[model samples]
Target: MPEVYHLIVNPAAGHGKAPEFVQNHVVPLLHHLGIAFELHETKGVRDAGRIGAEILTTTSFPVKVVIAGGDGTAHEMIEGVLKAERDKKDQALGRWELVILPLGTANALFSSLFPQPPEPPSEPSSLVSYLSDTGPDVLYQLSSLLASLKSTTPARRLPITLTSLESPISPPTEPIQSHIVLSTALHAAILSDSEALRSSYPGLERFKIAADQNLGVFFKADVRLIPPHSGKIKQYDPSVGNWVDPFTFGEDTLSGPFAYFLSTTTTPRLEPSFVISPLLATLPPNPSDPPTMDIIVLRPLRDPAVRSALASRGDEAASETWKSRIRQVMGWAYKGGGHVDLTYPAHRGETEVKGGGEVVVETFRCGGFEWVPTDAEHEPSHIVCADGSLHTIERNGKATVQVMDPGHDNSDDGFWVWA
Candidate 1:
């Protein structure tokens, strides 16, 4: 246990349910466990991060931060701590741990860390029994946190991605650190659009609506995959059921009218059911190992069937076909990230085509990647999302994303999570 638990609560998260949940459930549980804590509520955006930095800087080593909110709140807090570590160099910033309470719309980090069972209980049980026996299905994360608090096991180290904008047209900007995801193309557009719909939808439905609005749109960009510490950029070859060096010929740049391009560090699912990167969970990374990002790329033109369809059918018909295909891939993503294994057949017809040839989706595990928009006039292609927050790469600019080394040397003290 730490000197004290700094409970940072975001009242606006989960459509204003976080505060109530913290009071009714979390507070009582902490009291029951006889843990000393200080409560702080966030008034607006970035408040959580500010409070987290304050706690980390002022408190002693091995402090505990209980975040009673969603991924955005957690992201802000982590950013605060990381920023403090950068700025407050002379002062000793003690090591700390994060405990998450999934009170947000899309608890991506929480869901990835403590995934729910595939099947529910066969028999119904009382609320008390459920809490005592298996834990609340929805509130099970809290139970996991509490159990960890009582155990002697060390917290798990969390690897984060550092995303920087490199612009020749403008001066250098600050690098953004993300614990969950950093994306462009469709994912960035969806996150960018979904914020506008938050007031109206205020739930996961906003993402769906945003996806509908941006589904047919294709983002043009030049992507380059940087090799890991091993000096090899490995890609998942579905045929071999393993990762292989696809760029052995020294080709790393990928030209694309990309449909979807997203990368994840700690999370596999942005939503509970959305398993965008299933390998993150099934084949987890070791904390002591060099950090690498799991990237999911969808380039519709790479599929020969779609290409033949495009040449036979006009742009409008090909657009519809690709949109339908994207939708199908998304459906597969929800069903245990099945989209990754989809392959294209060698042949095609004028009518609708189903899978069976070269792998349609390109999945890679790399240390970093760079995204450069091909057209300066196309603004959507420049949009970049770092942990749900949106950014734009300037004209003739690009974004470079790399995993930060965690506590590899004496100069750095990295982050960890109470898993």
Candidate 2:
């Protein structure tokens, strides 16, 4: 049980409804429960992290931090907690727990654990995407957190997937420890474009518009899935709901003039109900297993229908047709991640269109991966995204990632969330 409750709230969240709701709904409820608490509202960029680190370092033992914000706010708080200066000798002196209140565009990390379908919001929030849900469901979630804290149920340590971006001009920057997702290709492109539409559209429609803009661009790269030494690379078997290694089919490397490539730590969807990586949510990894990321990759050239259709068409026509197919795949993603279960065969020697013969989506479970984009040939492909933050991998530089689960490996002190 918590001795004190420290809430880091973002007033900007839920279209500025966070403060009003937390104050009226959350505060009174906790007070009624006799929980002692303090509220801290974020002022500017990275302010949440600053506050979180300070609390992690100085807060009383057995403290519970209730983050009344979205994933980005929670992300910053976690980053602060991880980067804070704490004596290694005092690691056992205190206990900390994190609780994200779901107040952003996408509450992918928190939703992965709760998996409760959020109720619709009565008013607009900061962004009108997955995090817009701020109805009575929020009360239920808070109550559940209360139950967990009051009971003996232990919080689960969330595994982080770290990506290191290296450029020849400088040493590798601090690894982006992502609890939800690390993405590039179509995923990053969409985020890059959609962010610009934030003020204009301010809702999920921006993502659709951005997707329309980025669907045609191909990402040129050579990729490799790096397993932990002596471990095997694995892929999801949708038919059986199990994981299997595709190494038997061929070697583990992939070269791409790619359409889509994304990896998830635990999130099954970038937004609620999109279900981009369905199995991640449905079949969470066993505690005894090594930490791994769920990756979804798409290479246009692999589709026979697209290949044959493009062969007869002019270069421009071929590109347009290819984009159409890709849009189809992305469209299927929203249909409960149905894209992964699909088989697109070669119709008229063309694999770009759905021929219904072979599976189009390539889903894998890996320890990490290397994304090396071709120089200038596909500059857009070099862009990478962790959560919502964008990073660009310069020419000749590559971004690599590894899974880190403190609960399983404990090589380093890490983080956990209120389950």
Candidate 3:
């Protein structure tokens, strides 16, 4: 029998160009290749997941799921995969491989694997800028990519980021899966706030407006960062240009009045241009290695000067310092991913330093992490973003995020992505 394909296309995804692209581009290509496929256009929220679940139940052999939408639609398909796996009591999840059509605002997962994008336009493109500034050019670029794909191409298994929220009385909140990111603090707050303004602002500008609204909002949490590869929990030192051992401080679990805490798996960015975790971009993931994610954390208390300044002045002043530092470091993201290499004077209430300074961002290469929220009552702190979907942690509850892969043992099951 010939290979079969199932497609989930979301018309509302990615500037409303998906439906047209599916009709004009995708269908023709599959037909030309003599492929047998089934296509379903998403009608409402979670429909894609439902459809994907239905597809999973009906199909037995290896099948391809071609999702032509945004990150949200891709998320639904994964959720469907999880649900189907549970319903059928299947241990493996590898039967279905996926191909993204990249028709969403972020298209974050798409940008991660294809970092520089497929074709080099006359003008250089950044994922951040691509999502921020969408136009015919992007469509053309993506079309160029679709045209280049071969039907016989193989899909690679994607490492997963699983997040579980703690609940004492009832069953634990269902763990969320993240192919792209699992974030809290500033980034999560931004995603939550930006959604409300999405109608008014429309486009990436809403995110900027939302950031302005949530600036200086601190999150208090107890963090335990565990490295995927055993040894000491590694912390990047820009001065030495190496991942030095954090164990020298004689501690593992860290307490903080955190300003930002976010983790990414498989992908290196939240946006093509907004390369939040620059370390992952420079250090590529090895297929043979165990699945892992890089975390970018900012805690004001880690800085002696900032801590003293906050006590003497107020959180507002300390916040200003943090905001300035984040802005400075992120600017480097646009250059050559210099943000991860940023350092600051930790003793003088300083935020940014050019050379021979202590690292400002607490970078971690970890297998998993537990975030016990100190300010769960604080709305922003309770918000957790798993692949742009928001979930709230209950009061006194916590969230544990981890990265896992099949690693040849469960290779027959798990999620795979086609570039």
Candidate 4:
């Protein structure tokens, strides 16, 4: 325990329920523990980041920050602290321990850090029910946080990705740091559209609505994957239940009308049940491990059925067919990230095929990647989502992402989380 814990509360999070939760549950618990805390309520967008920077710059090492909101709030605060640390060139900075209280539409980071036990097999259900059924609620998460704080539980360092947009026509934008996810293509489009539905659908249903809207739309781009330091880029092979080289010719680049492209660092699931990158949880990264991100890729052209349909039936019909396939993949993702194991049959005519074929979803562990939109007029392809916030890559612009190593030189510095 530090001198005093700084509580950054996002009042508007969880459909305006965060402040109420803090008052009803968090405050009383802190009082019971005899812990001293200072409360700071966010007034508007990015306020938490401002508050976080202020606290970090004005305080000493080994500070504790209890964030009472969702992934977006946490992202902002981390960005703030990181920026502040970078700016303070003359002084040595200290570690900031984050205690997440999951109070938002999707508590991706919090749920990932403290995952619940696997649920039993069940039939497919609505998005609302699926989200509601999975993961621990605020009360459960709070208790876990309290337990960790009370015990000898050591803090875990967080790995982050530094993303920047490069363009010849326009000036460069500041590099953005993302602790959870950085994505383009379908995932980016869904996040971009979901904000519009936030008012109508306050819960995770908005993401589903956004997914439906963007499912038929394939993004045109060129991707280049970079290998991790002291390691080669490896792709997950469902057949062998292991990783291997993705390309036969040893090329590191891919051309795409990509169906889905998303990379994650900390969290395996974007929502409570949507396990987009299951390996992150199964093979958690160590502080000394080379910096790498887990990427989930889906290309409609890779499927022979989809390719044949595109050549014979044309774009619209092929798109409709692809939508069904995407829905199937999403169903698998909700079922403990079973999508990674999906493979197409070898022969297109094979009706009862089981084992051998190209994998439908490609999973990779790599240092970083770059995405360049093939067409300037392809508006959807230009969108990028870092954490929950959205950004647009200018025409002729490309986005580059690289994972940063969480150094172990000093135990008092860098971001840490109370698991």
> Each prediction's TM-score against the native?
0.89, 0.85, 0.87, 0.88
Candidate 4 structure lDDT: 0.80
Local accuracy of candidate 2 as per-residue lDDT tens digits, 1-419: 45678888898765666787688767866675677888899998878889977886666655678888788887787776666633343443235567767766567776666666455322222223433344567644564355344555667656778789987887997777678888899889999989889999987999889988888777888788888533678886555557777732368788877888999877887776778998776667665567778889888777765576668875566568778778677788788877777666546432333334666888888788999887565668889998888988977899988886454344334555766
Predictions: Cα RMSD each: 3.9, 5.9, 5.4, 6.4
Q: What pairs collide in candidate 1?
A: 344-357, 345-357
For all candidates in order, the CA lDDT equals: 0.79, 0.73, 0.73, 0.80
Higher lDDT: candidate 1 or 3? 1
Q: What is the lDDT of candidate 1?
A: 0.79
The true-versus-predicted C-alpha distance at residue 132 of model 4, in Å, is 26
1 or 4: which has the higher TM-score? 1
- For model 2, give the 10-residue run with minimal summed lDDT: 121-130
Residue by residue across 1-419, what tens digits does model 1's lDDT show? 44578889998888788888778777776676577889999999999889978886677777778888988998899898878778887766566678888888668888887778565323212234434544446457574465356455677767789999989968767779898899999999998999989999987899889999888777989899987765577787766767788732248888888889999988999878899998777666665667889999988787665676689987676677788778877888898987877876557532122344667788888899999899999999999999888999999999999887654454235667876
Enumerate residue pairs that collide in model 4. 95-412
**Candidate 3, overall lDDT?**
0.73
Return the TM-score for candidate 1, rounded to 2 decimals.
0.89
**Candidate 2: stretches off by over 4 Å:** 60-62, 85-95, 116-138, 141-144, 150-152, 196-205, 228-230, 247-249, 346-356, 405-412
Best by TM-score: 1
**Which of the numbered candidates is closest to the native, going by highest lDDT?**
4
TM-score-best of 1 and 2: 1
